[model samples]
Target: MRHLTVFDLDGTLVDTPRAIVETFTAAFGALGIAPPDASAIRATIGLPLGQAFGALLGLPADDELVASGVRRYQIHFKEIILPRAPELMFPGVTEGLDELRGLGITLAVATSKVHASADALLRSAGLRDLFALVVGADQVAHPKPHPESGRLILRTLGVPAESAVMVGDTVHDLHMARAAGMRSIAVTYGVHGPRELAEARPTWIADTFDDVVGLLRAAPKGLAG
Candidate 1:
């Protein structure tokens, strides 16, 4: 049986906090509004861009100001973040992905970024071709913690919920997996701590990217469940 492993982009496969933080700062600055502190911004890493800005600015996600901020953030991200893509990836990610592919596990991405931006970042990082599909917030009716993106990926890949696993670093990812009836692996090396991730009840918790590889290797049958 074939297995599918869907990953969250920002914190799972790539360490994008610096670029994200910088872009947020720049966006707020452009709007003449003070940006949230780096830690506060980092905590919102896996959320949709507008939602993150909404939380930071204390406005609704669809507020006009928040919309403007999101647009600015995207502009800054392209100018400042995409160029740093290759260096932003975490260690062991490339090797682990290659190993998983060798094991014949299909890979896909479900991220909070807009579809175009996510695709651009992956292509810049040289990881785009590794994934069979890349689903982003714009492509779905709802974003993370809603399960629409996860369900979309499974449907697009022709994989059953039980035969796929969602690997990510946030409660949003975990909750999405649960709502979609897929297993989850939460990595502690990202924005969330073990305690926070544990609340989401992930199937496995990984301290490093290599542990993710090991978990899958030890659970070939589990992947098919």
Candidate 2:
């Protein structure tokens, strides 16, 4: 069993992709830039907000445009995204979480979202108390695809990366887990399909949150928790 379970927020636990996409559209319009394709915006779900928008919208990653994009999104996010949120938290998510908690597993959230947003979403969705620690972008020096986010979570939980499993719905999460030397588990129901996540080399892949619990239970010793 995995001793430490790290999760991604947006696409992994909550289906807030619509809110995210709409916020990006508003941001682009505010900046006088063309909005990205809907699918491309959706595909940005699990990446770091700035990096995701920069990559999808063709904005220079290191330029002020990226910062402006984030700022613009924040302007409308409270009114648009937050109001539209607290969406589907995925089938079996709470159940699996409860099961893991019962088994004495430590849970942490390693997400690129700001801490306030992540906390609000979790509290609104009745999952605020599920995690022992919430390592949001506000708390981490680096976002996903970088090990720092996961490392911070692991540090907070007092568990080594060897004892952790990172559960998310994107290649970014997979890459993050890999960078942290933690096991990676992908779910197909999130932003990226199985095909897209396949190239990330996850240790396990599931179609649903329920399947994820099963995989975790059966995962070989020393792999997770």
Candidate 3:
């Protein structure tokens, strides 16, 4: 059966650690606020910008500081870092994606990035054409762990919950998939680690991008129930 595979952008399919760190640092610098430690910043990735800012700053989501910080962060990423940084696709991502497509699986992205920014990044990595749909933070009222984005992707893909999988590198991804009644696959090379991901109970854990391709090829039954 054909599958609808929903992938997360930053950690799962790409290593964007540089862009994330630099942007957050620059934004906080611009605002005269000391940036959170690098590890703390990295840990909160895969969340919405507002939420991430709130967590790092110890403020409410609706606080003006978080809102302003997010805006400044996007500005720095767009105007400064994006032009100079290398493309961020993880090793084997393109080959794995090609193989998964060859297996007749449909691919889409559900990420915390804004639609335009995520599209630009994917295009830079030459992976944009592989996705049937791209769902971004701006497009959804709520981000991952809320299930709205995953539900939207599955609906748009016309794939049943049981016939799809959510591949990502964070607990939010696993929780979102489970809440959507879809299978979840966590990749270790991303932001979070196995110990944390295990708490979310993914259907499977992949060590490399190729392992994801293998999982889809094997099409393990009863995984997405």
Residue range with the least summed lDDT across 10 consecutive positions in model 3? 79-88
Q: On residues 75-103, what C-alpha lDDT tens digit does candidate 2 reach at each position? A: 88777766545556787788898988887
Worst 10 residues of 1 by lDDT: 216-225
Highest lDDT among the candidates is held by which one? 1
TM-score of each: 0.97, 0.88, 0.93
lDDT (10s digit) by residue, model 3, range 1-225: 567899999988878876799789999999999888899889889998899999999999899999999999989878755564345678888989998888788999999988988887788777899999999998999898789999999888788889989999999999999999999899998988999999999999999988888887887455444
Kindly indicate the candidate among 1 and 3 with the higher TM-score.
Answer: 1
Give candidate 3 misplaced runs (Cα > 4 Å). 79-81, 84-86, 220-225
Q: What is the lDDT of candidate 1?
A: 0.93
Ranking by TM-score: 1, 3, 2
Runs of candidate 1 with Cα error greater than 4 angstroms are none
- Please list the C-alpha lDDT of all candidates, in the order they appear: 0.93, 0.82, 0.87
